[model samples]
Target: MKFLLLSILISVAAAKISTIKVTGTVLCRKQKQPGLEVVLKESDSFTPDDKLSQTTTNKDGFFEISGQDDEWGSIEPYVYIFHHCRILKEGCRTRSRYDVPQPVINGVYEMSYIDLDIAQSGETYEC
Candidate 1:
């Protein structure tokens, strides 16, 4: 019984932890937004929890967010891009949400081309 319990503990210790890697872009008024904030968190949640990670877009409006969760599949992650969007220039969502796929163990999830674009109103594109 002692040996069996030890083996189980070892297996649990070796279980893979999940770390999410996300990369994407932010566009506003049809232009790349540098220094804009990009946030990663649990999607569809209102727990007042802190974000898993936060980053700023690069000069070309690109960003990367990476962080580790205690366990795999514990959180449904999403990206948020907050920008000041001009009306009629580019259609967008204010607290834009983009799904980050469930990651493989210790894997890199390269979300290379997500465009978090701001829009004219909530009526368009229902993002």
Candidate 2:
């Protein structure tokens, strides 16, 4: 049992560390949408998704977030945007998730421009 525990500990310690940076701009009704929340996260198979970084869009509706994680395999990175782009209800917003492509791992992933006025496939409403 001791030997097995030692091996497991060593393997966990040897997990690979990966880093990613993401940048994007948000637009609502063809105008820059400021103050929207943006989050960088890592998707996990057996556990809750990990939040890497979080920030709000600037006055220009531009946001930049970066994160790092250690895992047995490559980290699956994504971005979640929370905004009140189209909803009229007070204190309600929509959350959208965008997965980073594998080719952009370990480097900067430019999302270009995201227009919140256009609905996404898997977006959800939140309060």
Instruction: Write down the RMSD of all candidates, one decimal each.
Output: 6.6, 1.2
Put down candidate 2 lDDT per residue, 1-127, tens digits, no spaces.
9999999999999899999999999998889988888999999999999999999999999999999999998999999999888899999989988999988889999989998878888999987
Off by over 4 Å in 1: 1-16, 43-50, 72-74, 86-93, 103-105, 118-127
Residue lDDT tens for model 1, 99-127: 66665324555665544443323322323
Position 79, candidate 2: lDDT: 93
lDDT of each: 0.64, 0.92
What lDDT is obtained when candidate 1 is compared to the true structure? 0.64
| TM-score per model over all chains | 0.61, 0.93
Clashes of each: 4, 0
The best candidate by TM-score is 2
